[model samples]
Target: MLSTAFALFCFLLAADCLETHVHGDLFVPDAILRISAQNISIGGIQRYTTLVNGSVPGPELRVSEGKVVWIRVYNDMTDRNTTMHWHGLAQAASPFSDGTPLASQWPIPPQHFFDYELQIPNDTAGTYFYHSHVGFQSVSASGSLIVEDRSNPPYKYDDERTITLQELFNLTDVDVEQRITADPLLWFGENNGFLVNGKTISDYGVIDNSTATLAVIEVDPGKTYRLRFIAATALSYTSFAFESHDGLEVIEADGHYTKPLSTDLMQMGSGQRFSVLLKTKSCDELEQSGRLDYYLQVETRERSAVATNYALLRYRDTCNLPESSVHHLPTDSYPSKKPIDLPPTISGFLDYQLQPLVPNNFPTTSQVTRRIVLNVQQFEDGYYVWRDSNVSWSDASIDSRRYTTPATPYLVSLYTNQTAYLPKYDAAIANGGVDPTTQTFPAKLGEVLEIVLQNIGSISKTNVTPGLLETHPWHAHGGHYYDLGGGPGAWSSEAMEARLQGTLPVLRDTTMLFRYNEATQPDVKSGWRAWRLRVQNPGVWMIHCHWLQHMIQGMQTVWVFGDAGDILKVPRREVEGFLTFGGDVYGNGTHVPERVHFSEGG
Candidate 1:
């Protein structure tokens, strides 16, 4: 559904704009990411997952706060299209670069490239990550993005370690996608095991002992180390704890500083990040106890069954010990004895306790302009499909050929005054939720919104009983929101009123909607989480569950911020001729000759 005016405008300008790369301010690529398919061994199995630069978890990207980082991504995969999403950073300045397929921009064609200009604002420095937002590719196409505060950092530590956590599967992306979309939908089973820094020794037994090496964290005797934990899981809620360690204190979450809170274990779903300080024990104390190494245990939470993995935390002096000695540390094997008791797990209370170090700037209830409530439900005629309220959103198009290639994205439509596909505020006001056709909730320039997300059981066409309720890690695309609070049962205005009284809200891009045990809480819907935010970013942004299977089954919605006049004011060089179907109409400036385009869409 390309608007006539926009199509004509492109045709008219196509003749004269061949040589011009772009006018106005332009930022070149600071880093180049060549995405391709690679074979990597995880837990003794070779997973056919897409990788960035031939690595499973990609590379660690470090940038400074209050600066712009331009990264050019080339889709080297021969068959599929891809896009990368900056998980924790608020991409307000560069809305088109937010990287949601068919929402912010189109998927980069095979052998084509797209440039992402990310503007990191001041006072936002902590653990963050970037991942492929298309389909289930993010299971392996993710890496750590750390923003350091050079001017003034809040905490002090001797050194830092980046731990990218994920669940490794034995199946390929195509196999899982085909099974999910088949006539009788098949669920992708639980991960084989968890990974710490793209490596782990199986706790069950040695699998491919030659290739299975546990991640080792070598530290001096008595020094504090900042451990940045990034959960890049496609599914499962993962928790991490160090054996016999008592000096762990969390100092950051998402991309903001948090008040120091001590805890025995930290639990995080996919797309969540946290930084904690771990003070290592003295060598004398460890020698007296007859142990120079400890197990960094990782286990799954809120699953049908439990799966555990381990890594080694070795003292620096232990590396010099003789191979035959008792204190020698082996990085490829597990300890002889496992801990009898695991630590208690944390849930929604993690958000409640860790207050933001930055001052609270959230608007009061009286200043709020709009409020929306959405219930996450499942529908199954034969296959499972998730919906918000009554609308089920899909990324596919009508024609079979254009299944992965939809029409122009909403951002392009809004920028070019293509009103046919845009969402209307009046229509959204008339309807309780978003219009099913548009699949968007419209917001004005500076409106404050209070959104409540409730978790409900499944409903079917044949009047089947409500299905099981599970945990959903919901993540916002454009910006972070203030997490008000969450509770069991349905959402109530009374609970909202009580939680807003003299409370300082914590800011998080991703928050969990917990699931209650069906046996304990029978005949009851499980949990709900609330958030408050002001719509300042202008563009199309998606909010959905971070779990890839739920998202693939249609558990997502979009928000259209500002009107045409506001959206059209964005710079012309930023939007036009980037990765649209016209194939860089501005000529050779956007498309580098290093790679030849073989296909248009996935």
Candidate 2:
């Protein structure tokens, strides 16, 4: 009897993975939606084509447990090349069709097509999305890719809806480049306007003439609904909430199931997704009135921005809640501003320094490796830049590694370079400072590695964002490690360079964002800074910003897994040299490295 019951339970769990008929000829469908600014008195005044497929928010695709999913992408864009990446869904198995250009696969050229197959091993369910992994994230090219639930869920919901709030900077491909290259801070793409479905916040203000105000989704009030939200903006931090006649309840986040957290305020950032279960107990409004109201509010002010979307709860007149008003909030319905329990601050999101969100789940503290900081400087023009000669956009450009010259390393001339150098905002780190002639990435793996991101020059709060001091989420492709804090230095440079004379723990495909410094307390909401990960995965994995821009600018690098824990055969090599990392880092993916073959005498 016991064996029969166990077998029955397993059958039920496996039954949750129902297959969906996929329309091949597409890998990540570039969305084609309409975008118009809100509050435009005249209708259709400012309009443009958005990258979402057939719908403003594209379709969601789910892969089965232990199955391979094949994707064929068709790019209809006549202008820029486009590619799609299954964001947050790392490849531990084949890692094919990962969709990152050059580093992973070549991008699908304009008006062309490409096909890829992903071999998903273990079963993992979550609310994930696929976007143009090639270049600018906000300019165009992004859509959600949901991996359906193969296992029965605990929550009860009759329907499910995913809301992706995106921002649009109405500039042409070329125009955006100039603005970003000139003043990355002012570039609207960084953290500008938004689109729900494919419209803007002030949809009500300009519902008739504006294209941005059309994401009103209709729903029935008597039925339970699930709202899956993804914060896909480059750098727009939000504390979002939903309001109908009553309040809202949230159930899941980052695709992982979580205990319900009922609050009027919740925060989400780029690369993060959440699921909210909206119950219909008080859904009587649909019957009494005529229309059930759902409101999404967003504010773009001095230091913050927020946006949210909801389904218009519909009912067959017998429901119990207010019916006349669809989803209505008082004219001034936004809650009185209150302190939120969000991550302590932006630093909490930057895990390159003191990774806060990363799980410190590694073996024993066998190794303590330290990385040296090369550059962390912010400019008056609102852009920030990091410099180091020891890294490559894709580990070593070649599939193979070469040994010689100790990678010809060098520390930047901070004092001299600070005053003389102008800030760079493009991705083109093609430099000869380190002799690519001999050096390679993941030098002798299996050794305890400590990568330090030193901040030199000066940081000005007046020009940069508040989270500048905070370390960013540093994700190691093939390993996991603990988080060490971020500061001026550990104990003097010489003493600190003692190297990891110990063994390091093992980590696999984990990520961590750094915490902000509490010294200059500004906002104590998002907590994070720097972190370390144990490299265990033995493959070529690339790490970059979930946001498209920062990543386009050489923000990505390769993590190579050498022989596991073989320090003797793969001993570290110490050498003498001065090399600079520069160029193509800020270019479009395919274009970045090419720039190295052309300019600065690379």
Candidate 3:
């Protein structure tokens, strides 16, 4: 009887193990995200907004590093198309999953679905995010992507939190786009309020005694917490800080580990993320002194209109009561203020030195194979046009309307031997022409390329502030680049050589292009930013200004690496899948429509 019982137990154990492997481990991080439009209450007013999985900020997606993730996105919205870009993920082997509309694949139209299979590299374990890549849809359809490191971490922290920073607008996304096209100078409409993690403190002026709940962070005494802050705003650059809390350690920026630097205030531009470690005070002492509540403040930067938003941080064990029962601190405790005063040495966000914790194995500056100089300038041929290297990037619909012929997708052109869409550098430079509308620079695989971005200030209109240059945050897809030092003025070959003689550069995916100033002691001139990276990933990659307005206005370009022969190595099946479904799928899955163009008129 004992032998028979033992044999039966073994059989059952085998069945359980088989089921676990087949169902649990194989599909560990699978998710089905439903995209639709819904009326949600912000502060007190109800407004129609785009949403993913029925939430403003969507859902927090956590996946372990070195694992595969499958996300099936279902578009249920009746009016608009949707595509989700895994921002900051290299998408090295799976370029189709990059999710750039037209460039990677067609937009998922209403009542359609798309499955994205992504493999997270073992080395890329950091804070990232996902958002809509089509039009202004990302204003609401966005979420945080946290990649957990399997190995031990370099820093110590007892707990962690993720906070998404955004700005709330009264006008819908469609209305905002229409306004942008009508007013050339208007990039974004006025934002009504700011939000922290899709929640904010009720503003008495905007709404009358609203009962909106503020985002709360509960922490134990004597414990350290790591906070991952993501700037998901469509238009604002935000400065964040915790009142009465000091010794914040910034350890990571833009999904790359950086040298630990301590700072009082942290600044983040759109599409940027930073991780900071905060040490909490003891609960016993705080409760005794009646100082258990603290405020997390976020303020807008680099804009004429400014607003501040606040959240709550309370000690979990201070009162031994539920979080909802805890009384909120007085609204007047944290007053809205201008930029906080910091020492001259650490005043701007660019002042902090971000050195990569892990050394990259790439060629040095002296070993660079290709060098390109691109200048950003605003010109007026018939209308205001922003151009980089003589060409203002545009899509098929825009080119067809302007030139009477639809342009092909840059990525498709690169891999399929369609060279018309590629930029003719020699002709463009010689004639100072920006014809053809679509532009791309070509590079060979494994070549170390250096791109110097020279910024020339545009002439401001009489009604606008004169002599004020707009600050641009530039971002690149596919891989992170090494940020060589940059300075004021057009970056000449001599200037680059002198700058590289100084300290070794760091790795960064998103960087700021500061405005030029001539009267300063240093006599800053037109801004210049430079970066170098090897073309290890053989695919078409996009490099563009992160400002949503700038990107839509042709302030973007692509770097096509390798020839058609090299692209053939990428699985034919995968390439065929994109070719079959790419371009505008709004009607009949064709490239264009007679009356409605997907890429024209904002």
Best by lDDT: 1
Ordered by TM-score, highest first, the candidates read 1, 3, 2
| Per-residue lDDT of candidate 3, residues 147-196 (tens digit) | 98889778889989998987777777777655554334454445666678
Clashing pairs in 3: none
Return whichever of 2 and 3 wins on TM-score: 3
- TM-score (all chains, Cα) for each model: 0.88, 0.60, 0.81
lDDT of each residue in 335-402, candidate 2, tens digit only: 34432223333332222221112233443334644232323322333443322343434211222221
Alpha carbon deviation, residue 220, candidate 2 (Å): 4.4
Task: Give the whole-model CA lDDT for all candidates, comma-separated.
Answer: 0.74, 0.42, 0.66
Model 2 stretches with alpha carbons more than 4 Å out: 1-55, 137-139, 154-156, 183-192, 201-210, 217-224, 244-255, 258-263, 281-291, 299-384, 387-534, 563-602
Tell me how far the alpha carbon of residue 248 in candidate 3 is from the true structure, in angstroms, after superposition: 1.0
Q: Candidate 3: which stretches are off by over 4 Å?
A: 1-29, 183-188, 201-213, 284-289, 318-352, 379-385, 394-408, 413-438, 459-468, 492-502, 516-525, 570-574, 582-602
CA deviation > 4 Å runs, candidate 1 = 1-28, 202-207, 318-326, 335-337, 343-345, 396-406, 461-465, 500-502, 519-524, 571-574, 585-602
Residue 54 error for model 3, in Å?
A: 1.1
Q: Which candidate gets the maximum TM-score versus the true structure?
A: 1
What does candidate 1's lDDT look like per residue over 1-602, in tens digits? 23476557657766211123332135356887878987766666666889988787899999998777878888888898888899978676666578888687777777777767788888788899999988888888989999999676788899999988888877788777666665456776778788888887544445467668888878877789999999999888887788888758999888888889998877888999989999988756776656677888888888877788888777777334443332745776666766525644454657567788879697888888888887887766656677776655556432232122346777776666556767868888778657555768888888989899988877655544556677889998877899887877788879767866766787889988886543222234667889988888777888888988777777788788787766555345434564355256211335442211111101
- Please give the distance, in angstroms, between residue 442's alpha carbon in candidate 3 and its true position after superposition: 1.2
